[model samples]
Target: MSYNLHQLHAFTTIVSSGSLGRAAALLNVTQPALSRTIKRLEEDVGASLFERHVKGMQLTDIGAALLPHAQLLLREAENAREEIDAMRGLAKGTIKVGAVGSLAAHFLPLAIDRVLGKWGNLHVEIIEGVWDRLAEGLINYEIDLALSTATNDSDGIVAVPDCRWEDNSFVVAAFGHPLRKKPKLTLADTLTARWAIPPKGTAPYEHMRETFLSRNLDMPDIAVQTRSVTVLKSLVAECSFLSWMPEPMYDSESKAGIMGTLPIPGISAARTLTAFRRRDGILPRPAARLLDELRSLTERGMAMQTTR
Candidate 1:
């Protein structure tokens, strides 16, 4: 059945704002009008979308399922308008990107800077998280692009094959840590060391586990686990904890002599980084622009490595 954009907007706004009155205020319409819009939408759907309550409105199961589809349609409609505006010389659009901590630290900023330099009017929104969150953002249409460690293509998200690169992961510790004094080191030496890392099941955590398991060593007992990059870095730098991280994620700290990679011969490994997008829908132009910049930067980086 066909649905009106106004009705969908009102429905989603109510869900976000948590009440008819607040949504009406935000939409610059009367509460009665907002209510009517939702009623019509519910009629169109042939289902009670929300249950009214003293505190606030709550979504019915159908409404909960419809939210993502509605949001996706709204986002696509906005993208269409932005595309027309750009063609008309408005040069205005928004790029929604989600990335893991490592890419957000350096590579993403470089590409974003280039995009902003060229299209100063464009708006950009970024969410930094692990792969799971990035993938969720893609499926929900919250982000048009995702930069993350390479993973198998899942239900609604697919990698952009050409937009991939490799980064090295290393076992690192603060420069002042006792391990730095050792002329030689092995994975076995780190078994007794306190460790901090991303939570179990994350790509970084899995990589660390595999590194130890490959050599028949048990994973070290983790002293702390966190998703916050700042917390993890502080623990490693100030608390004498060892951690595994991609080079870019800790590059600045390394350059500043705050931390250094352990010289364990086989602990370092390469991980493939990839760009991902929703399997369906045409990517918005602004995201495409940023993706182009990412590709160019990756090519330049690879070229420099080749020359070296």
Candidate 2:
């Protein structure tokens, strides 16, 4: 059972404009055409969506319930059109992008390369911060899209679905340590160990906390907490501390047998990644297209991972 999108559009316009005449004026169609649209929509929905009221047309119970979905559907359809236009080189605009350090270093650059290759003149500004701070920037309207493993959805922000990807992260230590050669590791095994962690409010900190608590363990004793993972990486190389670093970072060191990740049983690599846009405004077309490309790239990456 499918209802026509145009009818829903006409019904929404009539409801919002408060009268058939006003809706017709707003839609740039005649009153008769708009009426036919609503009548067709009501028959398809199997209910009367509005009733004559003193002000104009009042939404009946079914109409009231359906209004939000209708508006959303129409907006999404328009966004799709805009995305098409952008791809065809008919739309132009700037997109401000935000990301934490690692995502800026790893994924976003590749996505931007694809975006610019397609659009030719897509103006993009990159804002760098830790995830929590980047999310705050979004809430404050300082940035348009954020790429991160964690998305703290809040007022005035919407998290885009199907935007997350899996990351098989590692717990790395300098090779000189006694436990470095161990083939297996556990949450309990790492509990008493000193570690360099991102501060408590950021993604890495929360991920570490959640992973431990999920295993029924209390917070591991952290030796240092800082926002910079670059600094933390250098710290891990010379100290006895353990830190969660993505597997790709240690691949070079692993070949030399100077750094390695402990294989923790019952644990696999995973992470939540999301793209955020403002809740209250129109999304610029070019940015939206870039998001689509990013989504496709992420899907392909996940498929390759599954195959391997």
Candidate 3:
């Protein structure tokens, strides 16, 4: 049976608010008007939606059965309206964005600022997570877009080629670390030293493993396994622990003499930092604009800082 959106909206509002008076107040309609709307809806459906009571209104069996369907219809209608608005470039919906820590910390702010300045109705939420979590979110449609260390496409997702940044992150330590002063630091020189590494499944860990194996060396023991950049940076600066990180992660600190890359050859490797989205998902106009801004920002030169 065909149903009007207004009837479904009123029905859902009444169910949510649990009383005619409250629903009227919530919908900003007079009680008689709301009652008539509900009555007309009941006529259309040929079922008593609510069993009126002295204390409050309770949904009848039919109302209980139809409540979920009505809510779904209302949600779909709202989504359709938002999509139309987005197509018109009238920014008025929440855009969910996922990103790794470095992108969230350094690049996201600028991109967000650019979008927020022009569109007052736009809202963006930053979900800071690793590639595994964010990638899963993108595939499952929970995230609208993701900035990741992955350049390649996975199942049900694609990366924007223009938004990708090639990076060569390096093994680093504080300037005061003995390895930094080594006249000729070799692969064996770092094997026994304490290391701070990311969780086992991350890019940094894989890069470290590949760096050692390419040179015919085994992976070394890690002193700490952490996901917090703050903790990793602190350990590398205050202790003798060597850690691998992208240049942007330590640039300002490096200039302050708190961090520096170890000049070990063959240890640095190239990886792409990319912005990704689901292949089947279409972004709202505001989010699409922000995605374009992200591409522009990265393309203009997201350069790694030189070690001080």
Candidate 4:
């Protein structure tokens, strides 16, 4: 049975967006048209690709198996177009970058600015989420490159050289939080305090949990669990709630006296942030340049921390 590239792409987009309407919107097509494409593709495959419900679409086992292959095909097709464009000496193309929250806010703009300065015609789409989700986007080709605190290998993805970092020492507590005024701080002192933390199973969550466990203490009270660093930071700043985050995450606020790092020593550890991409493909010049800028930023951050 033969499959159409457009149909496969529609299927992939639907899987990514989780709803027919959203997928159609992303593809700039009508919902009816997207539905027809999926139907035809399902007929060609002889199996239902999704489980449809009133709320959203869920991929079937078959659909799950087909997704990676479809993504690879789509990526190759895109690469072909980009290569041809490059051959014509056009320095224009969109780069999709996935980054974690802090990097998105702190480093992504700087990197984007640098790349845009060199290639004024380039467009960058920034998608921010937890590291795991971003890594999945990189593997699926939904994002061309990812900046995240993850170094574990994903299939068909490679980490660029010297991109890993272990200097993200995070601390918990907010400015004027009573805990900060204590003569001495300990894990037990902060156990009863409400906390905001990353969602479960993420590196930050695991790191915070291990930090508590290593001290032979029970997990602290988790008052809020979310993936958005903006929300986490806001809560920590405006309320007495404690949250854990990298030192760089609050440099500006802390300097403004709007936030404070509690002297809770030994509660934080180094987190590795790495940039990754598909192992088999060559990045277009725009993506390559942005990546170089990100690397340079990481290097500068490390240097600044060393001198502190």
Give the candidate number with the greatest lDDT. 1
In candidate 2, what are the lDDT values of residues 1-308, reduced to their tens digit? 67688898898888778999999999999988888888888888889999987779999999999987787677667656756676677875566789766566567777888888877767788887777777777765467688776566677777888776655566778878666555665668887788887888777777777777787989877889887766776777777778876554455566787676766766545776678787866775767777887788778884224212
CA deviation > 4 Å runs, candidate 1 = 17-22, 42-66, 86-91, 299-308
Per-residue alpha-carbon lDDT of model 1 for 43-73, expressed as tens digits?
Answer: 9999999999989999999999999889878
lDDT of 3 by residue, 127-185 (tens): 77778888887755566789878756766788887786666678888888887778878
lDDT of 4 by residue, 1-308 (tens): 66689999999899889999999999999999999999999999899999999999999999999987787777778876875686576745777899876667566777788888877777888898987788778766688888877666756787887765544656656678888878878878887888998988987788778877888988887899998877888888888888877776777778788776778776667667778888876675567778888778778774235213
Q: How do all models score by TM-score?
A: 0.86, 0.61, 0.67, 0.73
* Cα displacement (Å) at residue 272, model 3: 1.3
| Global Cα RMSD, each model | 3.0, 10.4, 7.0, 5.6
Clashes of 2: 1
Clashing pairs in 1: none
Q: How does model 3 score by TM-score?
A: 0.67
What Cα-based lDDT does every candidate model obtain? Answer: 0.88, 0.74, 0.79, 0.79
Misplaced by over 4 Å in model 4 are: 1-70, 86-91, 280-282, 297-308
For TM-score, candidate 3 versus 4, the one ahead is 4
**After TM-score superposition, what is the CA distance of residue 34 in candidate 4 from its true location, in Å?**
14
Q: How many Å off is the CA of 147 in candidate 2?
A: 1.4
